[model samples]
Target chain A: MRNRLVVQLVDFDLAAEYRRLCELDGAVGAVVTFCGLVRDCEQQAPIDSLTLQHYPGMTEASLGDIVASADRRWPLHGITIIHRVGELLPRDQIVFVGVASGHRAAAFQAADYLMDYLKTRAMFWKNVAHGGERQWVDCKDSDRQAAHRWSQDPKRQ
Target chain B: MIKLLFFGRLGDATYAAPEVFEASVGLTAAGVRDALSSLYPALGRALFEPQVLVSVDRVIVDWQQPLLDGCELAFLPPVTGG
Candidate 1:
């Protein structure tokens, strides 16, 4: 699979990443992308800033594993994953996941699967700056459920 | 000797990143945990928590996985990334 996995402290160009995948192969028919941003509010409180931490070596390796899992389930021609670390503010882009495939269904499903897997599998932590303090964000039950769905679905298996 | 690394909240708790431990062959990750707990009670409590995870050479592994002499073990908190 043609895949790009990047973990950096720099911002990414979403359009450029998507365009690059589209250019990689003429057979590409569909491209699906997801960009995660730091939201302004959490639990009704205004978040002042955000910081992302990661286990550097494991972060890239784990992301590659997630992309590989998506490739196993879908006919993806290309995939791009970029996650940013360091201090960030509300509305800042935190992540990007894109998939290119010969059909729309594969592109969509693979992108969705990559996001779900990355949320749980990748070794990154998020800390929110709120009310003169910073605290680590707790893992949401919904994310675990979302990632688990891929394992339980016989069609994907 | 083996390198025991900590990341995320676990790193904050220990106030250390990669702590080292002298080990013999066939020592399991659980044994290392036991040693750490004995050496640093705070780390012991934090590590024994249900959410804490262990990785051998950067890949997540069970606590029962045996530690090699020069392996790097990492303690990871629950992930919160997208």
Candidate 2:
């Protein structure tokens, strides 16, 4: 099985996750992954940190739904999904999506698709600590645009 | 009646959740926006031409939503996540 999904409140062990993903090998020749880091900049505000929160039971279900969507959309051999909730500082990893496939194309595209959808369609939001103050933020227009492009009937192959 | 709620800057300017007198009209989102613009003049300055969008039921919605009675509408700004 090449699918692994995790939605945890604790800090994820990156090394263990990397190991579990590589344990199975079939059609996978390459595994590509991306981990998003909380940065100090958010639309020009000097962000101190962020507390990402979600509707617990529903968030995992949604992550599973998204990973399944990617599997149907791309031919893949292995997949790993991890997301972080609770407070995080700058440079702290917030999310990770990795995919393994027969070739680089599947891995690359699926990773991108997962993130694009996660940024927009996912029901996670943040209580952002910016410039000594905190507030909530909605999904970015770029993320929406990225999601809109995902439905391009031609790219699913 | 439904509330077209706002948060952050939108909330601060209006100082409360701005209400539309015809919120009970079962209006389309676009229509609700127009109602707010007319009823709360400040909403016209703050939200009439916003750099942001709205989300309903935790998902990005189009200008049209088949809102039934008692649907809590949430107005949101663009999200920035790591």
Candidate 3:
């Protein structure tokens, strides 16, 4: 199966990416995908848009490591992770993660694992625009907690 | 010489990335951080705040890690990506 990892300024097509993964291996029976979007409000404040920034070489390397980690833990056919940068309006797609495998469990866990790692470790930063003001978003404790679980999972390790 | 990079809000405050620094032999990442903090105290305060992450040559590392000559050092603030 084909594995795709990308960071670009353009939007990602989730259906096409998932279809590509599912079609890559004929034996694949399950495909799990996650798409993160920019919401209109955060913390009860209205937001106009979000600006995402990331390191060029380092961002790619970090994402590769994350995918490799997921690959080692699961028997998977294919995986795709596409993240967008630059300014994005509300309701816009921010990231896409897809996994294909013979069973639903493997695909589901791998997709979750990939998204967890991508949240804190992917070297991306976001700035939110609200009420004519803009500010960089802070890391959430919940996100860190989510990523931390994999570290403690013996099977995942 | 070591190449230093600042990303996200750190870049905004520092106003530059890929800045160069003269590093002596046996310097550690922590040492270089202190030197940078003092050199640009404002950036130092903002960048080294709790939860900041550092990398050596693109791989995440502890501050105590030794710095190699010609290596690239990057400072990253808390990430908020999905």
Candidate 4:
């Protein structure tokens, strides 16, 4: 089905990933992609770098479940999710989510849904280096709220 | 034996390598947590926190979940990745 779910220590090519989604099916008229980059500052402090840690087997499995949930919600032609691990400097790409569908609304919503779930459901943990100190990033209540909204959608139920 | 793993801040707090623990009969996830807490007090406190989660063989489970021999047990802190 041309779905790509990956967690790696290397960066990914957004163009290449988008092209793969386009080629998944001739009916795919829309492809939406979301790329996440490390911010340069955290809490007004200039960040030096970020390190991501993840559980090996569980991380991949969790990604699969997220994709599956998205597929169940929308009519998606293809999906691509790539998350980078290990040390990353500011502005470095940390994650990519792409969705292709027969129409724009499905593609857009699915991509949004994928990203929301990935932020909260995926197993990767982010640790930031800033102001000569290192601290693990805490899960934001907003991220949890974003994920919760999807479940609260009456259409899904 | 159950293999134990810690991630994120929990990993840093414990500075632990993946360790094997002998699982006695009818060992529950809570039992393992209590046992490990005595060994690593910092980890104990973290695990008792509201956000920490326990996974058995890579699947999130409740504290009452039973452990089987050769299973992997992991304590996950609140995840923050995009």
Scored by DockQ, the top model is 4
Q: After aligning candidate 2 to the native by TM-score, how far in Å is the CA of A4 from where it should be?
A: 1.7
- The most accurate candidate by TM-score is 4
lDDT string for model 3 (A44-111, tens) is 88999999999888899889899988989999998899999999999999999999999999999999
Q: Global lDDT of each model?
A: 0.88, 0.70, 0.88, 0.90
Query: What is candidate 3's CA lDDT for residue B65?
Result: 92
What is the DockQ (computed on Cα atoms) for candidate 2?
Answer: 0.21
Candidate No. with top lDDT: 4
* Residue-wise C-alpha lDDT for candidate 3, range B1-82, written one tens digit per residue: 9998887788874344338878888898889778777777787787679888889888889888988889998988988888
User: What are the candidates' individual DockQ scores?
Assistant: 0.77, 0.21, 0.78, 0.89
Interface RMSD after interface superposition, each candidate? 0.9, 4.1, 0.9, 0.6
Model 1 clashing residue pairs (backbone): none
Q: Tens digit of lDDT per residue, candidate 2, span B1-82?
A: 6655664456654344454324444566666666666767776566655655554554547767756555556555444433
TM-score of predicted structure 2, chain A: 0.91
* TM-score for chain A as predicted in candidate 1: 0.96
Arranged by TM-score with the best first, the candidates are 4, 1, 3, 2
lDDT of 2 by residue, A1-157 (tens): 5688776667777777766666667556778888888878877888888887664454676677888899898878778888888888988888988888888888889999899888875546777787677777766777888878878757554
**Interface RMSD score of candidate 4:** 0.6
Native-referenced Cα lDDT, model 4: 0.90
DockQ winner between 3 and 4, please give it. 4
Docking class of 2: incorrect
